[model samples]
Target: MLTYCLNEYPSAHGFENGLRPQLTFICKAEGNEAAIPRVMHKHDERFELMFILAGTGIYNIDGRGYNVKRGDLLLFNAGVLHDENPHTSDDLLIFSCGVEQLKFEGLPLNYLTTRSQAAVMPSGHLYGEIRGIFEQIWQQVMSKKRYGAEIAHHLLSVLLLLCRNIWLENNPEYSSADSLLGQKIKTYIDNHYKDEIALKSITAALNMNQFYLAHVFKAWSGYSPKQYQTRRRIGEAQSLLLSTDLGVTEVANAVGYDNVNNFHRIFHNLVGIPPARYKKFWLTGHIKS
Candidate 1:
């Protein structure tokens, strides 16, 4: 047998001493027959990593859609908006965890990657290793045994390092000046999606011609400005429905809909189900649709 010693190989790159990640929660979802959406939202103080254990879906991250499949890992850095649109195939399984107080050297708070990097990456050859790590974490969390949190903490560090290595190997090269304007528009909308704003307001705030802004934004995001804002509002409405005890009208108004009828129409059109039934399906595991 051959053995290797760590002291024999000094690495030039290593994790910073200040790096400490706190695991907030770990969850696994499977066997959902309906492709219910987890709408556009972001965590301001934590990072979320998800492994698609099976099935395929579309994840909209930072205004673009990624077609993700099994063995794919998705990273949602803090304050980055994302929407989950699962396909209605009934075999989707996902393992996800949330981490707080995470900061990498030279990176923003809770960010594992730069803005240029794609949020979704295929595990490829590392599929087994990555999946095993998630499974271990899930077991620790579910068992609630002694030293479980400590064990999961160490495992999280290893998982993060593996993700960083994968990112380095991928060497993302997607950012450019052309995308900046589109991103700016998205940021503005994200900040004010609940407000009664218009295309003219966006153009005036960003100081771009109305026509030019529309053209560039459509080209970059595959949705017109109005379309993007509508989706954003509807997405938040969906979030409030399932996650909170707010009533339907209250939910509608909270998401910027003054008229509940209009809200119902729009929500039904986009989500393929009304708000009340959507919440009922999630709560009761039965959908009339």
Candidate 2:
């Protein structure tokens, strides 16, 4: 299986100018597959949107499994855990483009990360248009013509605008307190997980009382606000420990734990192992029965 580590375009290189929303097209041969070396990797500044033009595959995103086939589009937020592997013998053709320069007017970045699976499957001409754009972008990238990146970025921005419009049209109806509010709260926690974020702060941000936000968030996401926050922080910590060379203390800080002892205690309670051991296991990529 092919392994890829997506990182920021190095700053020192002149490639930074070309890095803005450049399309990367992959056409794998039969018998070729790919895997993410670990659940996560170094945090990059850009997001990725991928569409499968042909063939079938299995996508693994933060332990969730998805069946990918032709016409399937997938979005990944910066720092989210994700990987894809081909499942069929047919050659796999995929179009991937950066979202750094694209402005998705009505949709929040958190929406793409939290609701990516559902958003990709939404019915309507939106999906069709996105698929068509991907096809054209793939052709442009593969042709290696002059100004290909410029053309691809423009097409990708148009597709994103269409998607944002569809999302705005459906937002009110599809966004229940549970899904919408829960997603917003989750995003907040992800950004503030390392700090002592009070429930009051969370409720205030949502313009709701603590009681209502807590109850609704739990009902929708299957975890209380604090519980979900801790879980997410720990999950991110685990990913960093396993994937990056950052030290344990740095990983602890990365996830918002200032006290090393507290970090160890929580890591053990949630992961059932110490950070180092868990990292070792993650590196092995073993599927424990």
For candidate 2, the per-residue lDDT at 28 reads: 27
- Alpha-carbon error at 61 in model 1, in Å? 1.2
Q: Mind giving the per-residue lDDT tens digits that candidate 1 earns over 48-110?
A: 999998988878788766888999999999988888877766687888899987777778888
**Clash count in backbone of candidate 1:** 0
Q: Please, what's the RMSD in Å of model 2?
A: 11.7
- Model number with the top lDDT: 1
Model 2 Cα displacement at 162 (Å)?
3.2
Give the clash count for each candidate.
0, 1
The TM-scores of all predictions, comma-separated, are 0.86, 0.46
* Candidate 1, residue 149: how far the Cα is off, in Å: 3.0
lDDT of 2 by residue, 1-289 (tens): 9866556443222212333343333332333333212222223555666666566765544323467777666666655645445554546566666566432334343234344334343425555677777678768777889988678777865665555555445544445546666667777876776679899998787788898888777665556768666776776787777569999999998888889889899877765567887776656644233
> Which stretches in model 1 have alpha-carbon errors above 4 Å?
10-15, 195-215, 242-245, 280-289
- Worst 10 contiguous positions by lDDT, candidate 1: 10-19
